[model samples]
Target: MSIERERPRILFATDFSPWAAQAEAYALCLASTWRASLTAVNVLEFQPGMNPEYEVNRLFLAELMKGATQELADLKSRVAARGISLHTRIATGIPSEEILGAARAEDSDLIVVGTKGKTGLAHVLLGSTAERVIRTAPCPVLAVRAEPSDQAGKDSHPCAGVGLHRVLVPVDFSDCSLEALEYAALLAQRSGSSLSLLHVLEPVSYGLDFTLSLERKRGEMRERLTQRLAGFVEALAGAKITADSHVRGGLPADSILDSARTLPADVIVMGTHGRRGLSHALSGSVTEAVLRQSRCPVLTVRSPKFAAGHRRVIPVS
Candidate 1:
C-alpha cells in the first residue's frame, strides 16, 4: 500500500497515575517534534464489588471521569500552545483491550504509555498494563519510562535527533521482523540516520544439542544472516542513510539491547503482532521486555498505513 507523509498521530493511554500524567507531558513534547496529533485515553475497569446501591461508588466514578476529561483537556491546551493538534477520550473496559481497540479505531501510528518501570515479582503481580498494551496494540507502542526529574532530560536525549539519526532494527527473519525493518529503513532514509541492521542467534543448548558441530552450525547461520542483510541493503540501494549489518549470538532481546548500547542508537524500532489471550499467555514475554530494559526510547510500528503500504517520503528539513 502507499504510505502518506502525514503528521504522526500518537495515542497516550492513561490510568490517572502520576506516571500517566508525566506520560502526557512527554507525549506532547514528542508530538511537537513530528507536528503530530495527540490523544489521551483512560480506561475504567468496573469492579464486581461495587454495588449500584452505593451512591459513593457512583459519585467516585463520575468524579474520576470528570477529572480525567479536564486533565486531558488541559494537556491538549498545552500541546496546542506548542502548535500540535490534540484530542482526548475516556472508555470503560479492560485497560489493555480498550487502549488497543482505541488505537485501531483511531488509526494512530503510535501508542505512548508510561511505565512505572517495575520488575521482579512486583511486575508479575501488577502485570504491567504498559507491557500488555505493547504486546497487543495494533500500532507501534512507545513505552515511556517515568524517570526521576533529574534524569528526564537524560532519558529523552536518545530521541533528540529530530527524527531518526541512528536507527537500530533487530531482525529475526520473521514476517514481523521484516515489517519492522522496512519501517525503520523508511524512517532512516527520511531522517538520514545511519541504520544498523542486527540479527541475534540464540545459543545452542548444551543440554539438548547432539547434531551438527557447534562451530559449523554457527558459521552456516552467520553466513545465511549476512546474505539476508545484504538483500535488505540491495533493496535500499539509493536510500540516504548508509547501512551496516551484524549477526550476534545471545537471547534476541538481550542481543538487541547490547547492540543499542554499542551502536548508541537514537531510536529502537520494532514490531509486535499485538498477540493476546492464549497466544500472549503462551509466549508470556515480548518486545515490551526490551522497552523496559532499553536505555533509549522505542518506536513500535504495527498496521493500517495512512495511504498505501509504501514508505512515507518525508521531505528533508
Candidate 2:
C-alpha cells in the first residue's frame, strides 16, 4: 500500500492471542480517536532449527500462512463493520524484529502491542516481544497489558467504556520525560483528556539522624517539586489542557502505581531511556517497572534524537 506520510500512522502487532486481541481493540480505539491511518501486522516465526525449504515443512508453513491470512481478513471485516478501514500485513521471522521492521517501513508514529504484564529477572531473561519492542522501537510504543481472568472478556470493544478521562505522566525534569510530557499534551488535546503529573522523590536515609533530617525536609522538598511540576505543565495549561500535579516521597515505581490506581488514569504516558546491555540490566528502570505492573496501558516514548544504547538515558521520576 502507498501510504501518505503526512497523516499520522499507527502500527499494531497481533499474534491473535486474547491479550493481543485486547491490544487490537485498544489500537482501534486510538486510531478511531486520532483519525490516524492504521496497519495490523502478524509474524509467523519458527524455531531456529525449523526451515520452510523442506517439502513437509513448506506444506505446514503454507497452512499456517493460510490460517494467518484468514485471521487478518476476519479482523478487517470486524473492524470494517465499525466503518474503520484497516491494512494488514504478514511477515516471516522473529516476531519483534519483523514488527520493528514493519514500523520502520511504514514510518509509523506509534506501535501498539499486548503484554503479559509479568516482570522481574525472569521476564527480561525470557525476552518478551513487547519488552524488546519497547526497548528499541523506532517510535512510541503502547503496551496494553493482559487483563485479569475475570475481566479478560468483559470488553470486546473497549472503546465503549474506556473513556479518556485522565492521562497520568511522571515527570523528573529530564529531557526524555519532558518529551513524554509534550506527547501527553498532544494526547490530551486529541482525546480531551485531563493531565495528571506525578513527581516521586527518592529519599536518602543514612541512619536515624539522617532519617529525621530527611523527614523534616520532605515538606520543603515537596514544595519545590510541586513548583517544578507546575512549571513543566505550564505549556499544557496554555494548550488549554486541564492539569493537576502531585509530589510524593518513596520508590518511583510504587508511587506511580499508587497514583495511577487512586487517580484511575485511563493511560500512563512515560519516557524510557531505552537502556541496553549492562546499563539496561543494572540501572533499574522506573518506566519498565510501571509498564509491567500498572493496571492501565503504558505509552513509552524513547527519544529518537538520542542514540538508544550509547547515552545513559537517566529515567527521570
Candidate 3:
C-alpha cells in the first residue's frame, strides 16, 4: 500500500458545518500536496416512509439539498482556485452510507471527514457519522475534529502549513497495531516525516503488601516491552524511515494523547478494532477517544483480516 506509488484519490465529506469547514482545509492541503484528485460529497438524508410527517420532511429536505448544493458549488470553486482538481457529489441517503459509497465509486485512497467531538448522551442519540465511516470505509479514514486547542505547528487552519512532519502511532503489539505501524511508516516515508511508536503499559492495581512483587513484575514487563519494541523497529529496517519507540505507563488513550502533545505530532495514525453495537458500547474504543480529543488529525486503519462485511452500495436518488 504505497500511497506515493500511485496517484491518490481523496474523498472529503462535508455537511457545510463549521466542523466540516475545518476539515475542508485539511482536504485541500492533502490534495495539493499529494497532487490527488479531490471529491467533495454532501449527502441529503431523506427517509421518505420512515416518518409520519412526510410532507414536512419533504419540504425540509428540499431546502437542505438546495443549500447544500450551493455550498458544494462554492467549495468546488474554492478548491479549484487552489489549483487542485475538484469534483462535487450530492447523494440522497444516509450520510455515512453515501460517503462510503462515494469513496468506493472514486476508489479513494483516503476518506477525510469532520467529527463534532460529541460525547455522552449527544453521541448516543446523534451518533457519530465519522465513527461509522471509520468503521466501514474501505480505505483509511482521517478524522479532523471541529476545533483542536493544541495548534503547535498549525497555521490559521489547523492543518495548514503542516505536512505530517512527525507521525505518532500507538502500538499494543496486536496485529491491528502492527498494520497501523506499517501504514504510518509508509506515510512518513512519503511525507519525509519521522515515526514515533508508542506502547502504553497499564499499571496493575495491587494491595500495598504486594508492592515489592509489583515492582519486580513491572521491571520484567518493561524489559520485555523494550525488546519487543526493538524487534518492531528492526522489522522496518529497509523502509529508510526514521523511527523511535517509547514505552510509557498510564491508560492507553491518555498515554497516546500525552505523547502526541509532547511530540507535537503533526498526525496520529492508529488502528481500530472496528467493533460495533453492544461490544463497542461496552468496551469503548481507545482509537475513537483519541480521535475525538487529539489536537492533530487522526488516521485510523482497520486490520485487513478484520472483515469489513460487504461493501454497502447506497442508491443515489
Candidate 4:
C-alpha cells in the first residue's frame, strides 16, 4: 500500500463495555481526522440449542437485541455530536468471526477494538476476542484498553488529549517488520510525529561458555545490525520523516515494551506474524505480549503482500 493513501473505511467492534467506550473515542477521533467512514459492530453470541425460533430463546434474543440497539443508538448520537457519521451493525455468531466478516464486508482498512487487558492466568483461560481478531483480520487492527480510573476520571475520552508525538516500531528486518516500518513512517508523516525504530538483539550463549570468540561474534553481530538499522532509517530520508534507530540486547517483547515506556510513545505500530494454533502456542507472539502490556495503543498489521512493495499504504485514520 502506498504510504500516501488514505483509509476510507474504519470498522469498530464494541461490546458496550467501558473499554469499548474508550475505543469508541479513538475511532471517532480517527474518523474525524481522516474523514473516513465509521462502522460500529456488536456481536451477539448464540448458545447451542438456543434457536431464536424457540419461544424462550426468541424472547432472550429479542431482549439482547433491544439492549444492543439502544447502546448502538447512543453511540451513534455521541459520534454524530462529534460531527462524524456512524454506521452500526449487529450480527449473531462468534465475536471474532463477526468482526472479521464486517471488516471484509466493508472493505475496511482498519479494525478498532477494545481489549480487557487481562493477563496471566485470566488471559490464558479466557483468551481474547481482540487477539483473535488481530490474528485473522484482513486489515490492520488497533487494540485499545480502558484508561486507569485516575486517568479516566480526568479525561472525557482517553484519546481526547492525546496526540501522536512519538511512534515506536519494533523491527527485526523481516518482511513483516519492513511493512510495519512503511506504515509507521506514513503515520508519523501524517501526525507530525517522530519514529523510533527498535531492533532487539537477543543474547545467544552456546554451550555454557562465554568465550572471547563468542563475545567477538556478538559484537560483530551488533555492529552489522546497527548498520542495517541505519540503512533502514536512511530509506525513509526522502519521506522527510524523522526517525531514530535503537538496538538493544534482550528479549524482543521486553525490549519493545521498555522502549515504548521510556520513549513515552503515543502508539506502537508493528507487524504480526499471525501465528495460530500450535505454532502460536510454541512460538508465542512478541506482538501479542507488547499489545497486552504496552501503555499506549498498538496497531498490528498482517499482510501477505506487505513486503512485495505492491500494496498501497492505507492511512491510519
Q: Best by TM-score, which number?
A: 4
Clashes of each: 6, 0, 0, 5
lDDT of model 4 at position 161: 55
Instruction: Tell me the tens digit of each residue's lDDT in model 2 across 1-317.
Output: 11112357889999988888778777888777778888999998866688779999899879989999999999898788666789999998889989999999988888999998876677867758888898889888999885634453245463644556799999888888877877777677667899999888987757655666667777788888888787766756766889989988789999999999998788999988888789877786899889889888998988533222422212245
Question: In model 4, how large is the Cα lDDT of residue 16?
Answer: 86
Score residue 53 of candidate 1 by CA lDDT.
52
> How well does model 4 score by local distance difference test?
0.79
Error of 2 at 242 (Å): 0.7
- Give one digit per residue, the lDDT tens place, for model 1 in 1-317: 21235677778897767666556655766665555777888877755566735898788778877887887776666556556676788887678888989988888877888777677788766767787777666666777664534333233332332334678888777767777777776556545567788888888666565656877877887999898887776666556557778888889888888998897786788877766677666675547678778766677765535355555322111
The per-residue C-alpha lDDT of model 4 at residue 145 equals 66
**Per-residue accuracy of model 3 over 186-254 as CA lDDT, tens digit each:** 666556788888999998878768877779989999999987887666655556767788899999999
User: Model 3 segments beyond 4 Å from truth?
Assistant: 1-5, 48-58, 148-163, 207-213, 234-237, 303-317
Shift of residue 154 alpha carbon in model 2, Å: 9.8
- Give the alpha carbon lDDT tens digit for every residue of 108-150 in model 4: 8779998977789887776799999999888788898657343
lDDT for 78 (candidate 2): 77
Return the TM-score for candidate 3, rounded to 2 decimals.
0.86
Clashing pairs in 3: none
Q: Estimated TM-score per prediction? A: 0.79, 0.88, 0.86, 0.89
Higher-lDDT candidate of 1 and 2: 2
TM-score-superior candidate, 2 or 3: 2
